[model samples]
Target: MREFSEAYLERTREGMWDDSRQALAPLALDSRERVLDVGCGTGELSRVLVAESAGEVVGCDADRELLEFAGEHVPVIAGDALRLPFPDDSFDLVVCQALLINLPDPAAALAEFARVSTDLVAAVEPDNGAVEVDSSVPTEERLESRARRAYLEGIGTDVTLGADAREAFSEAGLDVLETRRYDHERTIEPPYGEAALTIAQRKATGAGLADDRETMLEGAMDDEEYDALRSEWRAMGRDVIEQMEDRRYRRSEEIPFFVTVGRVNGPQ
Candidate 1:
């Protein structure tokens, strides 16, 4: 599994559920008795689960450090996704957000979730391949799409597992219920905040691309190709900063997420 910094998770997941939570309807949270959020890093979704469900929401993660932050919101425990700490039928609903995409064997993890959940299993995953970016900087969109393709090709796990998660549910012996699409859009415009400024800085320095250098190289992209891409990325970043300074920069990234819900033990 890929490990992520709390800051990274926070930045990526910011305002994810703020837009519209209608996609979460299939989980039927209001009547849930017990809910377990696996890979509940920093408790972003865990807090939402707590808010939507009257039942107790427990967070479980393999990262002890992350668990510390999550523990602040709801009950947390250090546990692996493939091997949960609780026994069978421990939770009425078992769910994960952006977790399955990082796992090499998502079906195996779903199987484990099925073991613990007597009722439903759900996953909120993004289709990174389908990410759409619109930016005021002319080259920014092209460069971002280029970089994203390489990263997706190089990444070991299925980062684009979005709506196709139904296959995994079947493999885990769960009956497919429904899948809902949720568009999580992040935008940057005038009055740039600290986070936005920091991200722009990273772009100017090519630090963002540098972070994924190894992964991009693992794909069909060679060193020379990566170097050229990074150069263009940095140049685009400078343009973004200039536009921001003039209060003319505007960017929006729309990531499509699929909320796949499945039922265990067929129907009651």
Candidate 2:
């Protein structure tokens, strides 16, 4: 599995925290409740929850690299979401963001969430069923391609859980209180645009590009040609961003989850 480095995780944290915090604002947290953040990448959300709730927040993740970067921002520990280190009913609220869909056993993880949370559990997960790509590609092809990529990225079997998250919570015996959709659009600028190009290049490289394509991407182009290629790539990203702004090119979608106070119906 290609785990993200601490640096990359931190970068993502800085860039995406605002949208995450906004997605969480509707949860109506109590000021005195203790919260648990499962898969708390870089402790960004945990920090926000602590500050916002004026309460204690503990974050847990399997990746120590990310947790090391998260040091002291919030109380972070290295552990699996599927088997949390905490005891039953240890936390009043549990919040997981962009974490469940990537787990090998999402149901098991949710069971753990239900186990540890006494009052409520809320999770924000991507809606794979709502994924929209460019109209130029067939929807089925896009879905298959995304599934293959996700599998390669080590998120386990492909399942569209966006519409099923509520059911999952209910199965874990938590009452589903609210489910909302949040739309986010990100615009990459200049060199950052080049980084996107680099990612596509890497994907193509990994996917076995033709000799000419490989050569072009492997620095065979002249300085001017390279600059032109980068410029073209940046232009393409801008175009995609514009299309997304106009609801043309669809890239991502998420269902922000909220489950109210409940208890496990059976043995944990």
Candidate 3:
């Protein structure tokens, strides 16, 4: 599995879950006795699970540092997704958000979830390949697409796994229950705040793009295209910074997430 930094997790999850909860209904979480959140990075979903259900919610992750960060908000345990620490039938519901996509073999992890869950298993994942960006600077759209494509390819996991979780559930010998779509739209308009400025600053310094340069090259782009893309990427970043300074830059991103729920083998 790919490791994530605290900063990356925070940035990606910012403003998430604030829009709506309709997508979470499939989990049937109201009466759950025990709920476990796998790959609960900083407890983003754990807090939601606790708020939505009155069960004993536990957040588990492989990262100790993240567990510490999450412990403040929810009960956390150090655990791996592929080999969960608890015994069989440990909880009534087992769920994860943006976890399977990072896994090389998501089906294997789902099987683990099945082992621990007696009632339901759920996965919330994003279709990174289908991400849409609308920026005031039109070139930003195309460049972002190109950069995202390469970055996704190099990630070596099913970045589009959100759309395929049903098949994975079947592969794991689980019965499919329900699926829902949730579109998270983030807009950056006038009166740009600190988050916008921080992001723009990273782009302006070329530090942001440079950080992911190696990963973006992983089987996605050849050396020639990458060199040109990097050059243009930095140039676009400078433009973004300039636009931000003038308070005229505006951008919108839509990330599509699928909530897939499945049933465990037998009664608890």
Candidate 4:
């Protein structure tokens, strides 16, 4: 069970929030409906729902750091996705983003989501089936990708949550209503320039790439070397961005954002 630290959540805020809001648009939620955002990282999605639903959203997660950030926007509580804190049929809609793949038992989590919601249970997850590896990408960029893959493999969780989510929703007796794919392309800017670098650093640290922090620090190059490395890395990043923008990457499969809706069948 990997816990997201405050620093990591803050660093990835824009990307996470932006994707979540976009995913919710097609849901066509009523302004007055109550919603639950499960495994709501930093509660950004929950915040969007709260604003749109007029403060009728509640978010829950096991990470205290994320919940603390979430508290500023909506009612956030520390709880596990596998076991929700609410009673059955407590929400009109239950949504989860970027969460299913990370869970040890996604089936149980889906069952919980189904139990809590009365009208809908929607989820947005990355489709690894859509992962496009550009051969022209630089060595450092490729290194970063490899590191992420290795890290997810080490954690024994799926890197992409899309496939598993669809199956889980079905197993939980939710009707799959609408599914859409978004090939979101954006130019990541500076200050946030080295997303790949940051990812690599985190994975390295988490995986104990070296014996200890001191040893790891010693192995990592100084600012000068890192800057030089970025020159090449940026070129690769640019190539990837161009491909994504032009839809050039091979579409391995339909990477969909699963939006499901169903009426509660059993007694509350």
Candidate 5:
């Protein structure tokens, strides 16, 4: 599995669930008794689970530090997705958000989720390949794609697994019940906050993009090509910062996430 830094996780999940709940309707959380959020990083989804479900909610993660952070909101335990600490039929509902994409063998993890859950199993995952970015700077559109392609090539797990989670559920011997598409839209606009300013600064300095240079190089990009990309990336960032200073920068991204819900076969 790919380990994400606390900063990265926070950045990606900052405004998630802020605009939508339709995707969660399929879980029928009100009817659930106990809900386990697997690989619950920093309790983002766990908080939502608690809000939506009347059942007991527990957050589990392999990272003790993240678990500690998550513990502030809900009951958290140090646990792995492929090998949950609980016994069979431990919960009425088991779910994970953005967890499957990081696992090399998502099927095995799903099988484990099915093992512990008595009824429902759900996974909320994003299709990185389908990411759409609209920015004031036109170059950002192209750069994002190039960067995303290199990222997908360099990443270890199936980043595009969101669209096929239902297939994996079936393979894990769970009956596919429902699938919902939730578009997590992030808009970078007026009244920019600390995070937005920090991100813009990182881009202007190229330090953040540089962090991913090595990973991008793991694919087909050579050093020269990387240097060129960095130059352009920096330019784009400078423009972004200028726009921010001028109060003219606006950007939006729609990340398509699929919420797949299923049920355990046979009896509990």
Candidate 6:
């Protein structure tokens, strides 16, 4: 599994559930007795589950550092997604967000989730391949897409596994119940925040693309091509900073996340 930094997790999950949570209705959270959030990095989803569910929400992750951060919100334990610490039928519901897309064997993780849960198993995963970006910078969208394509190709797991998570559930012997689409929109406008400024700086220095250089090279992109892309990306970043200074920069990125819910087939 790929390990994410605390900052990266926070940046990606910021304001995740702040919008309407209608997509989570299929989990039947209101009636849940005990909920287990596997791969619950920083407990972003676990906190929301705690707020919506009458039951107790426990978060589990392999990263002890992240588990410590998550402990601030809900009870947490260090555990692997493929092998949970609890016993069979330990919880009424088992869930994860942005977890499956990073796992090499999603079906195996689902089977483990089924083993631990007596009722529902759900996954909220983003379809990275379908992401859309709108920016005031002319080259921003194109550069982002180019970088994203190479990164996706280089990623070991199925980063694009969104609604398709149902296939993994079926392989794990879970009955597919429903799939809901939720668009997580992130926008950057006037009065740029600390994060926005930091991102702009990273872009200007090519630090952002440099971090993914190894992965990008794993794909069809060679060192020469990556250098070319990085040059363009830095130029775009400079334009973004210039626009930000003028208070004319505006950008929005919409990531499509699918909430796929499934039921354990056999008796608990």
- For each candidate in turn, the TM-score is 0.98, 0.65, 0.96, 0.68, 0.96, 0.98
lDDT of 4: 0.60
Name model 5 segments beyond 4 Å from true: none
lDDT by residue for model 5 (210-264), tens: 8878778888888898888889988999999999999999999989999999999
TM-score, structure 2 vs. true: 0.65
lDDT of 4 by residue, 66-127 (tens): 78888898888888888899988888788887677677777677778888887677777776
lDDT scores of the candidates, listed in order = 0.94, 0.59, 0.88, 0.60, 0.89, 0.94
lDDT of 3 by residue, 14-119 (tens): 8788889899988877888999999998888888888899789999999999999889888889989999999999898999999999888888999999999988
Model 4, stretches more than 4 Å misplaced? 15-22, 132-137, 190-268
Clashing pairs for model 6 are none
| Cα lDDT over the full model 2 | 0.59
Checking candidate 5 for backbone clashes, the offending pairs are: none
lDDT of 6 at 248: 98
Q: Sorted on lDDT, highest at the top, how do the candidates line up?
A: 1, 6, 5, 3, 4, 2
| Model 2 spans with C-alpha error above 4 angstroms | 7-14, 17-22, 30-32, 132-155, 191-268
lDDT agreement of model 6 with the native: 0.94
Give the TM-score ranking, best first.
6, 1, 5, 3, 4, 2
Q: Give model 4's TM-score versus the native structure.
A: 0.68
- Least accurate 10 contiguous residues by lDDT in model 2: 203-212
